[model samples]
Target chain A: MKYPGGIKKQGSSSINYANRGMNFEADINVTNSYYINNDIAVIYKKPTPITINKVDYKSRVDAVITEAHFNTPSTTDYNGIYKGKYIDFEAKETKQNYFPLSNIHKHQIEHLNKIVRHGGIGFILVNFVKLNKIYLLEAEKLCSFIESNERKSIPIEYFENYGYLIKPKFNPRIDYLNIIDQIYYGGKL
Target chain B: MKYPGGIKKQGSSSINYANRGMNFEADINVTNSYYINNDIAVIYKKPTPITINKVDYKSRVDAVITEAHFNTPSTTDYNGIYKGKYIDFEAKETKQNYFPLSNIHKHQIEHLNKIVRHGGIGFILVNFVKLNKIYLLEAEKLCSFIESNERKSIPIEYFENYGYLIKPKFNPRIDYLNIIDQIYYGGKL
Candidate 1:
């Protein structure tokens, strides 16, 4: 199979999923690089956990993992320090008008909650890809919505009301720290 | 080859190095878990980066990585929130009297320096494994030493003068955070 730009795709649904996931993370990675290069903030995406099953040793100093499997992460995807404050978040993208709550795992939500309780900034960046809209919703607000409503998904209206819209840019791409400035520092930046 | 306690050696110096590294990190993990369980702090070691070379899919949802290699990390190992402050640090163990500065990469030192400049706490935990001595040396102190000294290795006298000794405990093992409290909070705790 071939994807756009003449890149051959391995015939696997998992590869497609992996590619899609990488796109979102790659955008954030570029944004983080811009921030780091500019001395603005130091944030990083945590690498995905891989469980090694087998390793082949070529020499005493050289070894290659021959088999491994992806493992679930216990924390959010991204976290770091911003202006001396602990900044933590998870980024997800959805094509639907309603964001499914199941898109986030229970442990991840708990981790976010704990961050907020520790006086660290915690939020979620939801990219409505079809709508070309990005929203930064506080972890507290998401938790409240989940606790109060019996709905399995959060409507677009809730995000519009409570979440801050992050405008995309050319160099930094997502410009999420702009939203952070508004939310945490009273738009000082 | 077989190691003691019925554990089989993986017949690779890299594996031996990995096992030795994991022993130090595992102790820190247990300590972090203790702090987390006690609501003292939330710290975690970032997962290692692995470059995936090939994947084998058995089903639509299942995929196994067939070939991969470990990649170098851009930042320090451990980071988290402690008492509403961002804490970042790297841990290194040495068997010699003089700790070699080459053990830390340039980029990692830059990362630690950035963390300090941004008003976040950053440090290095040096464990003299042979002597069973763990020292928590502040990032600024380490940077100044590196910048001022012409030598490639930091002598034990430097650590004795500038670094706080972290006493090992029964439950948490490496209680470096205790030194952190002493350094940062005027020993209030």
Candidate 2:
């Protein structure tokens, strides 16, 4: 397990003892649960898509699952409805100044576009590990960066120029919709 | 992977697949994806609810996921929107003449109750794997079976008496919604 800034791992003395990878997705889920419980919004992270086959329950009928695969070519990390509006975005973090284009795939970008087309707020949550800075960039800006002559990442300078910084926190952390309120609802929250 | 209705494996071929145990979820996902692409409806199998932490990238900051756990119980197996109406249901398969109550959890049953309370459609796609018989049982009736102390499952006689059977098909396979139309709506396809 790693820290919020993606720095040192959790010490052996820490509470968790699981051998599983840091529950990054679980944290978002916890955060989403918080949102749902508070009646603040209803958003959820899509599950890691998988296919199943060959379900063999001895007492139960042996079910045959033919094939399986991860459905998304890229990430559509978070999505839900808030205050009657749909919200969709991907959450990503890198320990570099410039987040790479490799993180955002073409298909993922298109997925965001689809979200926007359907009248949902679409954006990406990017964390600059070294700088310990996080920003929420809209789909339009992301598309331009991908389609730009650089044909690559959006420089840190560009992110600093255009992105809204997100402050990481504790207690159902990564409360992104607060930022969503600012961007989509014009800072009412 | 071994097939449910296919030949069994021997000669020490261990299962080393990510989707080793259950392919029922995967098949439903593929079937759902095909349904989504065909504009049949926008349904998605909820991703495995996970907790993420600890990420390390050379040039970029890693998003370290700290802790994780298996599924933390859920309300439905799949959810989506069809014709602007919320669709929710749990998928269960049994080889017996009756559907066992043990197949469902209390929380899941409660979840379906809430969905109906909120005016959304709630139901189950029950497949008798060995019998190759599928039924679309309304949540209302299910709740009744749950409320009674007479038995822990819906007897086969009851299914044959009241449940809507969903025959497996190739194109637009498992067209359960067609039955929904007949039951929930008055028109026939």
* Best model per TM-score: 1
Question: What's model 2's lDDT at A99?
Answer: 83
Model 2, range B1-189, lDDT digits (tens) per residue?
A: 464456455532332232312455555777777876776655566665543332233344322222333455566767655544556789887867788988987877876776665556778878776665667888888897778757878887777776788654443556777887787677484
Question: For model 2, what is the error of residue B82's alpha carbon versus the real structure, in angstroms, after optimal superposition?
Answer: 4.6
lDDT of 1: 0.86
TM-score of chain A of each: 0.85, 0.76
Q: How accurate locally, in lDDT, is each candidate?
A: 0.86, 0.65
Please, what are the lDDT tens digits per residue for candidate 2 over residues A1-189? 566556554543443323112444565688889886766765666666544322333444332232333344444766555665556678777767788888877767876765565555679978675675667788878877777756466788877777777655554566677777787678753
Error of 1 at B148 (Å): 0.4
Q: Which of the numbered candidates is closest to the native, going by highest lDDT?
A: 1
Residue A51, model 2, lDDT = 41
